[model samples]
Target: MKKQLSKIIKLILLTCLIFTSMITQPATADIASGAKIFEIHCAGCHENGGNIVRRGKTLKKKALKKYGMDSLEAISAIVTNGKNNMSAYKDRLTTEQIQDVSAYVLEQAEKDWR
Candidate 1:
């Protein structure tokens, strides 16, 4: 009886884990994918969401909001066109990649680049 109960508990835990993973997998995958994209392309200038060249235009929530760039579309436009010291990535990165990086930036901004 003890062995059966232990097995049942383990099975239930495993089932719960699988279900949780299924529910959260897409968001996790997007974040991980965006992290990779950011590392390859945006990390040099915006390391940890801090802009080296343009300090006032950092990727933080406050700076972004101040510059009217708080939304994903706004960020994507800036990334695509390149403003001020920032170079245009429209030719280099695909549309999907730009969108992914935008999502990643927004997520990091919300978390304050913890």
Candidate 2:
């Protein structure tokens, strides 16, 4: 009985470890699709991460940090809800697309848009 109980406890602990690792893994966004989406939808005013409509509000790393739009969540929220002159894409793009684009924007910003 003691051996059986120990085996069961070990199995449960191993299962919990696997479950925790799976849930804690970071989500990967589709960067290539995000680039394409940005070109089609956001390039008119934000070509190369430069905001033509609002020069100070560019997507470059510094500008994004200054405006508190540096994170994926922040960018995603703006894309989904829209702010000021920016149009909301929630009606036009799917949630996954939005997350991808947000990831792309942050990646580009980190690279200083090359």
Candidate 3:
């Protein structure tokens, strides 16, 4: 009976560990798909993170920070809903795609679009 209890305890601990690991793992956005989407849809106006239509509203780090768009949530919202001259992409892109693109934009902005 003691041996059976020990085995059960070990199984429970192992299950807990697995569950914890899964729960604690961070969700990552697909940057590659984001790059492709950007290339196809955004590059014309925002090549290399520079905004052609609105020079002051570029996607560079400084512009993003100055405009309060440095976070993924802000960027994702803008991309999803559009702002000012920017066209809304909700009909053209999925939520996952928007997330991926937003992550990609942030990553690029962080890198100064180099």
Candidate 4:
């Protein structure tokens, strides 16, 4: 009875460990797809993260933070609805593609457009 109880306890602990690892694992995003989308849609004005049309509205971290667009949701909204000089991409891109591009923009912003 004692040996059986010990085996059961070990099995429970191992199960918990496996679950914890699975939950903690980081999920990867499709940055390359986002890059392609950006190239097709945003590169004309934002080449190399440089905003020629609007110098202060570059994709760099400072510009994003200054314009209250430092998060993925904010960027996604802008992409979905469009703002000021930018045209809405809601009809052109699917919801998932918008999300992917938003994620990519945030990732690139963090990397300083490198």
Candidate 5:
């Protein structure tokens, strides 16, 4: 019993240490990557940071109003499958890129919209 308890304590401590290190590192948000992808690709249709009146609806207010999802998941699905007049991006973007870009859109909306 003592040996088993000791091993469990050590495992917990090691796990905590690993988690602390990960948290301490300068972690970048996936949104940053998504923003880059959007700037390069989606910006053409949707416009960067803000939405376009000519082509598509603005993502800022409309997204929160229409979909109760987080900006990240919303953007990823839009990028992957598209909606309405928008074209799907599953063939063009990788899963990692989609997640990153989704995050990026939220960041952009935050920075540019408000």
Candidate 6:
């Protein structure tokens, strides 16, 4: 009985460790799609994270910082709504596309900027 209980305890601990690692893993977004979207839509105003004096601000992580929303969802909403001087993209882009692009933006921005 004692040996059986010890084995069970070890199994439980091992299971918990695996679960923890899976949840803590960093999930990233697609860069190629994001780059395509930026080029076709946003690059004219902001290129290589530079020359965006008129378009309000760069879509980089730092620009999104003012809204206090860093998650993929928040960025998606902002893109659809077109905050401030930015034009709304709701009619232009699909929901899934927005989400994908948002995730891509986060993935790139964090790696390249913040």
Candidate 1 whole-model C-alpha lDDT, 0 to 1? 0.89
Global CA lDDT computed for model 4: 0.88
Q: Which ten residues in a row have the lowest lDDT in candidate 1?
A: 24-33
Candidate 6, run of 10 with poorest lDDT: 48-57
Superior by lDDT: candidate 5 or candidate 6: 6
| Candidate 3 off by > 4 Å | 1-26
Q: Mind sharing the TM-score for model 1? A: 0.73
Model 2 lDDT per residue over 1-111, tens place: 999999999999999999999986647899999999999999999999998888899999999999899988899999999999999999999999999999999999988
Residue ranges of candidate 2 with Cα displaced over 4 Å: 1-26
**For residues 27-75, could you state the per-residue lDDT of candidate 3 as single tens digits?**
6899999999999989999999999999999999999999999998899
Q: Give each prediction's root-mean-square deviation over alpha carbons.
A: 9.0, 2.8, 4.3, 5.1, 4.9, 5.0
Kindly list the per-residue Cα lDDT of model 1 for residues 1-114, writing each as its tens digit: 999999999999999999999985533226677889899999999999999997788999999899999988899899999988999999998887888889899999999999
Between candidates 1 and 6, name the one with more favorable TM-score: 1
Q: Rate the local accuracy (lDDT) of all candidates.
A: 0.89, 0.94, 0.94, 0.88, 0.70, 0.72
Q: What is the lDDT of residue 96 in candidate 2?
A: 92
By TM-score, rank the candidates, best first: 2, 3, 4, 1, 6, 5
How many clashing pairs does model 1 include? 0
What does candidate 5's lDDT look like per residue over 1-114, in tens digits? Answer: 999999999999999999999986533557666667877887876675445644335666456445654456676788899877778889998878877777777766666554
Residue-level lDDT of model 4, residues 1-114, one tens digit each, is 999999999999999999999986534557888899999998898888888887888989999999999987799899999999988999999887888788889898899988
If both were scored by lDDT, which would come out higher, candidate 3 or candidate 4? 3
Give residue 44's lDDT in candidate 1 (0 to 100).
Answer: 98
After TM-score superposition, the amount by which residue 30's alpha carbon in candidate 5 deviates from its true location, in angstroms, is: 3.6
